[model samples]
Target: MMSFKRSRVIGAVSVAVVGVALSLLGSACKSDRAVFSAPEETFIAAEVDAGECAAQCSLDGRSVIRSCDGEVIETCAAHLACGGGACQAPCAAAAADRSSNGCEFFFQIPRYDPAKFDQSCAATFVVNTSLEPVEIALAYEGRKLDLSGALFRTNPGDATLIPHTGPIAPGESAILFLSDRDPEVAPPSPYDLYRGRIACPSGVVPALVGELPGGTRIASAMHLTTNVPVGLSMIYPFGGARSFLPSATLLLPVATWAKQNMIINGWEANATGPASQIYASEDDTEITILPKVDIQGSIGVKAARKNMPVTYRLDRGQLLQLVQREELSGSIVESTKPITTFGGHGCAFVPSSDLGPCDTLHQQIPSFDQWGSEYVGVGYRPRFGNEHEPMAYRIVAARDGTQLDYDPEIPPGAPTTLSRGEVAHFVRGTGDPIVIRTQDAEHPIYVGAYMSSCTEGFNKVSFEGAGDPEFVNVIPSGQYLNSYSFYSDPTYKDSSLVIVRAKTRGEFKDVWLECAGQNLTDFRPIGTRGEYEFTRVDLAKSGQAGQKFGDRVCRNGLQRLKSDGPFTATVWGWDYAASYAYPGGMALRKLVNTPLDPIR
Candidate 1:
């Protein structure tokens, strides 16, 4: 069995003490916060490369896609300068062969109706994971939604860099607000909107290359690229007078584009809104959709029933969004060539509708080749000082006659056998973590974790509300990584993380976590026995009792976590009747070949 190896730095060693970003120290000198310390070498040191390099479109055969003018250009493979508008070159590589760093990416920001959810802050974060500095920009063609004057802000600096724009130092991030907000409109001072954008000054710059649409909000298909590889993440937080429901997901680069995928999402029993599956094409592509439920087509599309396959064609930079009242889980999507796919609910009342409120769900779907046979489901620990609530989950089978076994005992309502394209729904109620495994590596499944709904009686709540419905993919144990650079949205007052790692002989392999200069130590074991264990820690809290809805803050921006052995973490934030959840990160290694045993 594959297991996490301990870091070579040191074993269970405690080191320097950093100042806490929030909360007062206890009288006994004990931190109310969980202590998760590790070897001194676990914390990543940021390095900056002062050298300069000329920019070239290094996505291989991918064209520049578009420039100021709408003229087509030749392919940019060998000696071609990086200025022409062309489509991506053909990529026959498998999805598992790709990594976090890549030159090109396609982003179709999920459609959020202002009528249903707040659209105050929508942004896509681009992080330079590589050691060297890289130039990043946005690209699109035949736009449906205009992005004339969208703005981006990097690290603050003197007048050396472009106005309001500076070099994204290694391990730093650039925030691109996804709105046509006027440049002269003077964004909020200190930028206290979503995710806390800092570095005030002339460095903010318009990042798109098109005509400015006067104050028009954006929800369209666009492409982004860097001179070198970087990481991309999307966060849509409804941060206004209404609710604070946020949807977030880490995007896979174009190098990981795959032709086959399955939609695993929450089941909404009512007609509140439609569950959505969106496809963004980087080239002229043909796509076939086999939805598990009936789709109420719109505009130029026709309605289709369950098990019926619908076909559509999309040009480079074009997008096709399919929506239905019923849940789209178990849907099978395949294309002639590689394309980017996303699945989630526009807004859903998870488990049941009596939970009072709903939240939007969004996640970039990985290709079938990236699916795994094993996973650890650790439910989020109780916040608001209430009893732990069950976390909802779904396991979508990729092959027929798939068998499942749990480490301890299977949760109630779990199915041991599932046919192809079948989805089994269950919930984890206990605080202990559960390890789920398949019969063999040949049978793989996609696992999705969901936060239980917020109600008056079921969960303790203040005016800001308790945990509501949020959805994020569960990272497979085989895809665990040693380090990750992730961002926690500072808007939510109650923010926490669920950390899971592999262990052996009733001992932990030792991993460390640091956010806002404070290192976390002391992770307690959960469950009776297994090769894995988990612990939940609070990154930011509300009032004294940790129940306040609007009193949370953290160190300005992105957080980095490193360890000697591999582990997985999930971030959760909630307040004011809204909440959001997403995995810290995962390695998309090709584990299975879908073409050989195609998903039916």
Candidate 2:
């Protein structure tokens, strides 16, 4: 856990007003740092602590009063100008507000301590649309390299001069092979968000390689950006102390970051147990962790347990790891500013004691603001059967006073007065994996599915002795996408399948896949979760090539999907070749009507 020196904001003494309780979240080093509190209700002018402040004045509209143990500081108005940077004035004091997304950004993923694993990293990037060829460059250890040749095919030919004609077209994908290494310094690791102006020359969206350097170990949580809407995922494979490997897709931009989130440990029944990791990225992030014991124990008729409000201020690139030997152990994490969260079991068992599919699993939890009451969770039914494979689903509430009416009634029914940072846990219960929005929409709820480990290959039923549970973001129908260009990992022997389901009755008017050249003829029903239908496309049957699914020259790039209306699609990869189960993942939704650029 690396730490940056905080740039404390000191100010001139001035008239002060009553203060509110200050919230504090922190760094790894607690000893040398001093803690202080804000002035109580009636605060007056006080001297500024020049070198003692730990926070810089916020430029974004995310400023919150930060405090140490217990000390009084300047007023909110004054703190805004303390960081020493020349930023616009606070919006409250202005006649009109003006804050918008920046054109350039470099996300910082927390670095993993090298001492931990046999270290290896693998990644791929997919630009969301077919746009003018954007010039892309790469920066590693301070050395800049031109990556446009391998990643982008422009009108001005490259060294090969083969007259570029790749998935450089709309709805297509490409691979980034990064073997370029420089001597100045290794890419910034752990906690530090590295964004070099020189790294991305043309200033195409902040992003990442070929032959990718051999010593590559993306141990830390990763941060990638694209000039256009793009998606990328990195995996820290199984290794020492980390037999349960974890891989996570980067969440969408801060424009969509939410303040309230319900932790959904997307795992299954009869597992070794709950090992949850809570991670948040972005500045001005303040999270309050409501442990499970506190929630369940606070049930009506039962005396409330003594659970203190423990909040953490998360810096970009930091992950708050909370692991415990408890059942579905979860927490309600609330943030002040827009922040992204990821929760998962460190290492879990599918059938509890079964060793084969027991691997690490995690997914970036979507903000409740984006969650929908209606969700259709498609469970995996291997071509061959694994009778006992089970799944668990949790409904997380984003706000208090949420009213929930289920299609398949949940026993005690959802709590009448669920508050922020609370959750209701339940299994598929003979009913389908769908949560129907009923009784209320004032506060949204997130429906998450957890699948147990399964057979590595079709009917290879001997239970490979160990399998890993997998978690996925069961996107809401409201967020269904009409078009997407995604790829399958060639590292495995089997190809993954894409599940596209209709969001509403007649929602999926028509469907098309690149493989067939026309509307899908095999569209089928997926349990009628809603008054709609769904269909699946098996890329394996399309054909296989040395580097992709199609033949040489006609190589299969990212699979393109276009439907009449909006629909949600998820991809599941089987770890058959790895002799283990790979927790499947969902594609970054590029839905219909989504803005090409986020509003400021």
Candidate 3:
């Protein structure tokens, strides 16, 4: 019998006291490099003989004295406020206000076995969107053994509990690297949030390759918690600096987890296979997988025929990985408890028959509860100097008899109606954005965007002019927000953004990109779609591709977008047959029957 070691850490902090007790979430590390330190103290405020009020300096050095009746007795400045009978710093006072979505997130870095060689490093970038300074930390978990050997092992006594413990200033961003490479091989300088190199962990073992047997115990999932709301983007760069093979996904926080989800993936690949991975948020999570295509079996996991359901169980911080020879798009996953899922190919050819070079594809998927009936379908910008080049897209139905209507006219090969779990594929040329909607909210669907293949032929290699395959989810009109805080990677040679905004009274509203130092007024209306408009911009600091990795230029660091009406955006970049794209951000508002979890 195989035995696995597990740890049960308390989910939340609790304290019993006559007066309020404030305790920081982390303690000082005794290592030679001290990240943060503070004496864990219990303040017995009730025993203090001070008068009816208390006095103290705020964390930001603001002075304040407040009465016990929750009355603000004194405030040092317009931005300062009295808290716990003392002036509070702007960050401490704004700590109560979280991001629009959530603060706690958990995810695993899926294996990205490149077609040529194996690249083992992945990065998770975080942006602080709140006024409060964010403290990022990982949930405590005991080391464990899997069917392979020890997974993500650290040095003795180094438990790997903290993730660059430090304050992330408001509107600033940080990127942490997770890799199996040597620890001394660190990312270039100027990354504010990087603590050190972390060991890479995952549900799929590299040695086992395509087999994920039952009861595999590996502590490879990352458990991130923040004092305030933040946004996360995960990147797995497959090719080295000389070549481009990177895949990324904008991570959704745990508060957005749902009991039901649908899979959207790229075409099958011979290298790493097409797959979907799910992470369990609570113990004893029972999952049902209904494959749209026949699924291959592992050692202890049975194979399931198309439409046949297979069941599996996972606990918190544990994950289930499913890899199949056939493309797994349109599959349905249901669970007894909420779970987070990601779907993509290890390395795939966007137009499977078009090109020679292929790249990895990955995107975190939203659940059925968050699906919407209306979407803005925009194609990628012209690639490789071909102004007439086309991009591919797919719309997956969530309910039976879902009818879809397109503005102006539908694309080349799109279907007007679809059955539950069925997918409709289409291709649109550059400058041909369209609006897609169903009859009503009763018929919701998921939409995905894809970049065309490199050069479209094996014999003709236009490495410098063309970009390989890349995948990004399209945000629904219902999930659009007026403001977004995003990041654009400067590592690529070219970075471009597509902004889709709703129009009012046949007129497009004003939009602004704060970091670009420009106000956008060149919005072009989507084909005969009177209610919406879109435009694409190259994200250059001074409208030039001079930004490099670790550069604090407006094009590389944290970015801000604002508009009068609801809108959504996508940030993408390409470098010689390599590309990456992801949604700027979206509101995870509930649109179905799944009960929403409270943000902790």
Candidate of highest lDDT = 3
For all the candidates, what are their Cα RMSDs to the real structure?
12.5, 19.1, 13.9
Global CA lDDT computed for model 1: 0.55
Ranking by lDDT: 3, 1, 2
- Model 1, span 1-600: residue lDDT tens: 112211111112111111111121111012232232323322211121233111212122123311112122344443222211122221211121254445677765455333333223456766555444557667656533333334343221111222234556555565665533344454434333442222222333334322221111212466776665566777764331133456788887777777887766545544245445445554567777787788676665667788888877776666666555666777778887887667676667666644566667788778788888988887665654543566677888888889998867877788889988887778775265677889876788988887766763222332236767777888887677555556555455666777887662235556544442333455655445656767666655662122111232233135456554567878777766677777766767667754524325
Q: Candidate 2 on 315-413: residue-level lDDT in tens? A: 564445443344333355566665655555545554354555454555556555555655665554432343234455566665556676554455343
* C-alpha local distance difference test of each model: 0.55, 0.38, 0.58
Model 3 residue runs over 4 Å out of place are: 1-101, 112-117, 139-165, 182-219, 238-243, 269-272, 457-465, 504-507, 541-554, 593-600
* Candidate achieving higher TM-score, 2 or 3: 3
Alpha-carbon runs more than 4 Å astray in model 1: 1-97, 112-120, 142-164, 180-220, 238-243, 456-464, 504-508, 516-520, 526-529, 543-556, 594-600
Q: Estimate each model's TM-score.
A: 0.72, 0.57, 0.71
Question: Candidate 3 lDDT (Cα, whole model)?
Answer: 0.58
Least well predicted 10-residue stretch by lDDT in candidate 3: 9-18
